[model samples]
Target: MFHHRERRARTPAHETALDCLEAGITAALPKEVVSSTVDLDGKTFAVGDAAYDLDEYDRLLVLGGGKASGGFAAALADRLGSRLDGGAVVTTNVDTAAAGPIDVREGDHPTPTERNVQATAEILERAGSATGETLVLAIVTGGASALWCAPATDLTLSDLQRTTDALLASGASIDEINAVRKHCSAIKGGQLARAAAPATVVTLAISDVVGDDPSVIGSGPTVPDASTFGDALAVLDRYDIRDSVPESVVDRLERGADGELAETPDENDPAVAENEGDWHCLANGRTAIDAARDVARERGYEPLVLSSRLGGEASEVGRVHAGVAAEIAAGGDPVERPAIVLSGGEVTVTVDGDGTGGPNQELALATALELADTGTDAILASVDTDGIDGPTDAAGAIVDRESIPPDESETARRALAENDVYDALDDRSALLRTGYTGTNVNDLRVLVVPAAD
Candidate 1:
């Protein structure tokens, strides 16, 4: 699915890295995952290892919001066909038309908009109307936190927007950002489970968060929220942006924490306990990484999966990856030469300059600089599994020794310092632009090193 695949694979190592990346991304595609995990046989429907008798339920309703919700819903609908009564899903991909009984509504991502608010309201309404005899299929995936926007009664859409902006700009981790989001949102943090209480709600999730914590994915709309409003307030305080955030946000959180308002359902909550066994994660970062590993072996490289939970500043992570590559190239301590190092997880980018770039681009640029400084002959590539890195059109970027010569090391350093890696990579045709890849498991990084000449 890498659109500029031929152009990006300039060397044997680059080709191997791209091949591994494509394997990882394709493994996590929503359609493929859903079709493989869900099956129907007359009145018997099965998801994963669990089976349900369709005849027992009066209606089958689908409801959810996320980047993959559209594709997931479409795939499920293809299997259920007329069995699906009616439903609604919110998503950022507006290009894909609704293919089945489920209504696909447009929503925003990374930031919630008025359209997101409207579309999410419809999803909540459908979820709330579910009965005990109704079987609800919930698709919870990455970017759902922003796409499923449903502001609390005390807060407006603007209040949520300002708080979301502040938290994202603060370079907070996804868990921390989601902690604040759960408290501010009406449909998040197990509230959707509350809305669909008594109904047999089955959630099919494609995890993007590290550790695959159900409570963090899509801000845990279908699962219990272990975090409280006090925790949300603490996140803002930890970021040191509580005062700068919208006043309404602070007041609402303060009131909720003070016990004047109801808190999000925790593990003890009845609705959460009832559907605890129903939540299933069909795919995750490891699922993608495993696929990459097989491709690496087939390509005659020793694949070393460093970790699937890698996180931290994008550039700092790049430096670490560079160090490992240096080790392999110097003496092959970790493994013999002709090794493919892989890692997966979300990375954060602290925007200090007005330059345009995402975490993956920044990491690739930083890795290029480090490899040049250490005189390592290796190639590094990083990309968001969703095919959109940050707000840029490029998925991410690839860099190597040839991409950044010795004379241009200082220029690359300056570009990285200004967080303008996009411009530099664009000029060199190093950016990987694949449009939307129809899935998101997190960020994937690949370092390819050939045997010593």
Candidate 2:
């Protein structure tokens, strides 16, 4: 039997899956990951194998924004207390109180509002004004693309707003969205590092993007970017987004892409070629997936990591994962019965209608309906690391066959069609609300396939 109802009470298997996902997200944001990856061992900030003596640096200034910004910043404040003078960071929902020198600024997310812009500006200014004697520590995490929105000189906020909406609706990948963002922003794609030149800039980052490309995470304000306006235009054209986007956005792209366009710096760009600041990736998909594996092991379930960098449309991804779970229960291609399947990485939704949802919730609903057979029990939970997903209050959804109503297949299809996965799951109490976990290791998904009785 493939489809069976599950009790609402937390099963041993359920609790174990949750704990593993939580541990993975938590482990990815700790100081050990940050300090080690960024090469900020003790006082020395290493670039490649060479370490720079930072004894001359007077104060450590922490700055940046993201979903995991607050958690990562808090860890840094605790670990590097006293050395940190005063720096600002913004996150969706995090307890940010600096007992010492760190200054925490709470802000909105998922979309760039005026308030989020204001709070993030203070961080950018503080980092930009760093003296040669100061160590400007940039704690970057996911959701930073929306949390930290500062448009470039050529692009106005209104222009950016319109463009961002179009891109999100177009179901473009994060990399595609960020290509336009790097061109539109004043503090992305190494521009922030360029602004903080002559000072030591240490970027402590968490990778939410596939392949852990620094330039794609939070648009990589501290990392050198290889993408260009032309690249962005290609994306717009690929998604037929040119006509839908704002007029100014098109003008800027045309101006910037043509040889008349001020070119995005080439690989041998003078800014990075001359400046000496460094970047590091603290954690990523592996961190969360690995945690899920350990949790599955402890719970006496065989753990199968499907893939850490899962991608494509949110609902489509769910169907594929559902197919995999079914395989484990029936075919057992990778592992046998009583297995827990885990995956990490971001999934996106195309806003086809005015629906409230996130990728994870869409994933859950799709999986639930697809696996609605009998005799077997399956549970799928997908949640965003930062908490909020899409326009909904919940990050994502969790559902077994029992969670769905009798009209589930039709309802699920409708919700998926309108990009309203969160609401569809909301009625069933399937939405998982953590209200911001303080860290953004991207998206974590757990697919449980119980052993046949």
Candidate 3:
């Protein structure tokens, strides 16, 4: 799915890295996962290994929001066919057409917008209408936290927007950001499950968070919330953005912390307790990582999956990957030469410059610089499995020993300092752009080293 496939396949190692990257991305596609995991045989419907007798339910309603919700809903609709009742799904990518009875609605991502609020309202409405005999198939995936935005009654959309902006800019962990979001939102933190009370709410989730915590994914709209408003306030304080965020946000969080506002439902709450057995995670970062490793081995490289839960600052993580490559090159301690080291997980970028780039791009650029400094000949490729890195059009970037010219080293250093790796990489045609890969399982990175000469 790499758009610049020809340009990226400049060498044997680069081609292999791209192949592994494509394999990971393809394996995580929502449609493929959904179709493989969800099946229907007459009245017997199964998600994963759990089976639900369709005859036991009066109606089958779908409710969810996320980057992959559209594709997931479509795949599910195809499986359920005429047996499936009407449903609603909110997504960041609105290009996909609605299928069966699912209404695919447009929403925003990374940040919520007016359209997102409207779309989420409809989803909540659908959930609220569910009856005890209704079986609600809830789809929760990456980016749902933003796409399913519905601020609490005391807070306005603008308040949520400001708070979200501050949290993203602060480089806070996804868990922390989601902790705050669950409290500030009306539909998050198991509130959706509460709204669908008495109904059999079965959540089908594609985890993007590092640990695949169901409560953190989409802020746990269909699951129990372990975080409280006090916890949300603490996150803001920890990030030092408490005073910088909107006054409405601060006041609401303070009220919630002071017990003036009802907290989001916890695991023991009635809504969560009643439907505790309904949640299921179909795929995660490790799913893609393992698939990539298989591909690497098929390509004749000794695949080493370093970690599926790697985290930290993008540039810092890049240095760590580079260091590992250096070790492998020098003595092949980790694995023999002609090894493919793979890792998957989300990384953050503490944006200090106005430069345009995402975590994967910054990670690739930083690793390229590190490899050049240490005279290491290795190929590094990083990409967001969703095919979009930050706000840039490129999925990520790829770099090798020859990616940066000897004379342009100083110029590359300046770009990296300014967090403007996009321009630098784009100039060299190093950016890996793949429009929209129809799935997301965090980030995928591969380091390919040829046999020692």
Candidate 4:
């Protein structure tokens, strides 16, 4: 829920955008998604179309790490109750009282820390201890790439941290960045599944990636990796951050690519092949977008879902969306007046300056400028579904023509140029802050356009 709903809902249009966002995030909550997707009847355990006989397994262990893993673990813990044999999961945010019996540990996000390494080691240890009769439930979600940190041999936590920074600043896509990360770590790229080999490893995931690719979600700890070490090296080369990244990272990726080190398990690998069918994506960007669309229709607005797989530089994407709004306001080609345009996906921001703001914030800022320049009458709101955008505490931002008034247009443009949209939005009280929403299905944006008087 929004922290100060009244203050942010400045107009009826703004209120509609907020309502859609809330509904979309609420639909993907782990508690809500898990209860509907997973069920237990006596010894029978069901997830999606697959059902397992719990009595057949000697032990049931839960292991995972991510932004949403805590909530997911808690929900599962409530379902299994005494049947759970106890396990651990690392998260950036967690409600201790709601965690039931699962050991919920805190970790850093967007960057790996010593605490993350320690917590992840415990998870690997528990996963490695699984026997043939053990049934392992892995909760993989957004942010696990950092939460489940376990450096490969000869790599240090600092090495990973530096690499993470370089990759993030390089404007690499999540898939590309994760390809590099998977090779530099021991627990990613199907390695967790390897550690829990022979045991039935069932992965319950909340997809935050563009296409819901299992291998890319949480770096595919439980699924087979389609990328190779060569792919990682190529990503670094593509970004031209090879020299900027830690030498140790380059060495590890190079060694793996040269076959001096074993590659991440592919589809043929037994670690993943055995229980490959057990990977389940409980919710995704489409799930959020559709839920938001339903809310838009309920508000008497014709909703047009742009795409759930949108990608590219954030500011450029914002310009495209602004163009669509201008067209709809003029000719109403895509949809008639009084329409709500929606899109959900992860967008990248190429940080060229030492400015603060996430992709969603940058996008909203750019949209405001474009809308004002073209005299388009519309209101746009964007937020990371997880309730945290970039490194800032704000969820994202909201903008309209007045967001960047004529007198303040120069200041707003300067902010976007410096990648500091967070401050600019804050100046206008346009920043959308909602602590931690306990769910992540990528970024969600809603644009509301009203009919001409």
Candidate 5:
């Protein structure tokens, strides 16, 4: 992810899923992916399992947004160099050093801002000017929602702020949030690609969503979308949050969903493809899981990937992971001593009261408290590779038997109540702060159960 930079290997839980996420993240990085992924399955940089020639394209253009968009674009520039024309990209953890010929712009997460609106327009304009020979290389990674923000016309930035805060607090899923995002933006929902008609576009994505659907990752700037404004409204209504959203925002979506506005183009639509744009997923949840599996086996631990499609409340996911740890500590149904349980997926936060922790930190805190087995030693950690989880400063938190507080009593409940697990972990010196890992592979959780009883 860092292009051979010397960031220290953190004392993360030496579990499979975490290892895999780290590796999968490493593998898809522009530097590593271009180098190692060549000739895989007897193909090179193919689309839909068919390798394509890289030399035929006149100039490679990099344009995309997400948490890792900057890093991926930089890596592509390094490998493809003078072959790359210029383009635009947005990310949360953009490396200033890697900001090459591409326009690197930063934006907010979980919420859209005025700055995002400005940057997004530039992206659309750049895409609009592409040619038939243009090889548009898109780098889509996690944290694209906040990084690639563009609220609807009728709504103000204030509306986006409130609606986003409400939706996030309402416990909505990532899919639901993105559904709303696709409808409200000009650049998202394939508009960015629509602007680049007649250009040969190649989208290189790192999937942070549960399913690696092109339309869902960073709102599918190049891919056709199937969701409608009505679907987005249903999400809001289902959460009993219709009134909470801005009036103008609701009206626009209502109009769009009612068929008054054209739905996002489908691949079968005549307007696209001849638009000559194609997208490929460079990395995803499965990629992270695979990486962890290899590392677990090498470490002499029986590795198990719980699941990469984890969602719902962050605390609930933690409970489930904790249950697995308990079973292993007690009866050992799945595996015996020295086991690693790793999971990769974007978890949701159902904001009820108030909490200062993101899903990852919440997951770590919840898991630490749940696994109260006496005869077992397990080190559990949860982290977002992009360095920001929800609205917190630390990437995530770590919890081991030794790391647990002597009086983990009062603070745990209060932490959940106030959404301040980050502060709690901060007090305990268990917060994992990596600044930025230079890549976004979504959330990673590591549960390490050592054989030493």
Candidate 6:
């Protein structure tokens, strides 16, 4: 799926990293994930471990939003066939022909727009129409928070956009960002489940969070919320962006914390309690990490899954990973030579400069600096499995010891400091581009260490 594979795969190590990435991403593709996790029998429909009697429910409706939702919705439509009734799903990618009976509507990401708001209304309306006999299959995945935008009472689309911009720029974690977003939206944090109350809602999700907490994934539209308005406000305060966000957002959060407004549904809420066990995480970062590890073994390299729940600043994480690779390369202390170290998690970039680059690019660039400084021969590559990194067309970047030449090391460092690694990586033909891979299992990093001569 990488468009510039020919230009980027300069060595065996580079090719191995790319292979591992492909294997990891392919394992999490919505269609592949669904085919393995969901099934239909004579009269029972199964997703994960949950089974529903098709004869008991009068109608089965699909609803959700995310970067991966289009492929997921389409796959579900193909799986359910005529047994499935019509439903709406908002996503950045639209494939009407593939979506079959499901309405795959277009929506924006990173920031919510009027289009997202309107599309979300349709989902909420359809969900609200469900009866006790109706089965609602909520397909929540990464980016759903933005695609499933539904501003709360007295909130406008502009209000949400402004608040989202502030939170994104504040370097807040996904959990922290979703905490604030859930309180400001009408369908997030179990509100969608509340709307479809008594309808036997079942959430089939592809997790993008570090822990795969259903509430944090897609802001928990079909699951109970563990965060509160007080927690959201605390997140803003922790990031020191309380004053940076819109006044309406602060006011709504403050009021909700004061008990003037109802909080997002909790476990005690009847709607959430009824569907407690119905939420299932079909695939997550670990899923991708494991698949990549299998590829490493197949390629004759001893694979080490460093950690599947990695977190923290992207550049810092990159440096630490580089240190580990250096250890393996120099003394073979970690796992001996010819090792492949794989990890998956969502790393954040505290955006300070106007330069364009995503977390994966930043991490890869930072790792390149360490590898160059230590003269490590290992090849390091990182990518957002969704295929888009930051606002750039490149999924991420691949780097080796020579990626940043001795003469250009300072310039490369400056580019990273300015959040401008995209152009720098592009100049070296190191940018890894794979247009939308139709899935997001957070960020995947691969370190391919060659055998010692």
Assess candidate 1 and give its TM-score to the true structure.
Answer: 0.98
TM-score of each: 0.98, 0.91, 0.98, 0.98, 0.88, 0.99
List lDDT for all candidates, in order. Answer: 0.90, 0.75, 0.89, 0.92, 0.71, 0.91
State the RMSD for candidate 1: 1.2
- What lDDT is obtained when candidate 3 is compared to the true structure? 0.89
Local error of candidate 5 at residue 212 (angstroms): 0.7
Lowest lDDT sum, 10 consecutive residues, model 6, at 4-13
lDDT tens string, model 1, 296-335? 9999999999999999999999999999999999998698
**Can you give the lDDT of residue 312 in candidate 6?**
88
The sequence of per-residue lDDT tens digits that candidate 3 reaches over residues 359-401 is: 9999999899899999998999999998889988999999987
Q: What is the C-alpha lDDT profile of model 4 across 141-184, one tens digit per residue?
A: 89999899999988999999999999999999999999999999
The best-first sequence of candidates by TM-score reads: 6, 4, 3, 1, 2, 5
In model 4, where is the ten-residue run with the lowest total lDDT? 93-102
Give lDDT tens digits, candidate 6, residues 354-448.
89898999999999999999988889999999998888898999998889889999998999899888888899998999888899999999998
Q: Rank the candidates by lDDT, best first.
A: 4, 6, 1, 3, 2, 5
Name model 4 segments beyond 4 Å from true. none
Per-candidate clashes, comma-separated: 0, 6, 0, 0, 11, 0
Q: Report the alpha-carbon TM-score of model 6 versus the true structure.
A: 0.99
What's the residue-level lDDT of 325 in candidate 2?
A: 79
Off by over 4 Å in 6: none
User: Between 1 and 3, whose lDDT is larger?
Assistant: 1
Query: What residue runs in model 2 are displaced by over 4 Å at the alpha carbon?
Result: 1-8, 30-52, 274-277, 373-376
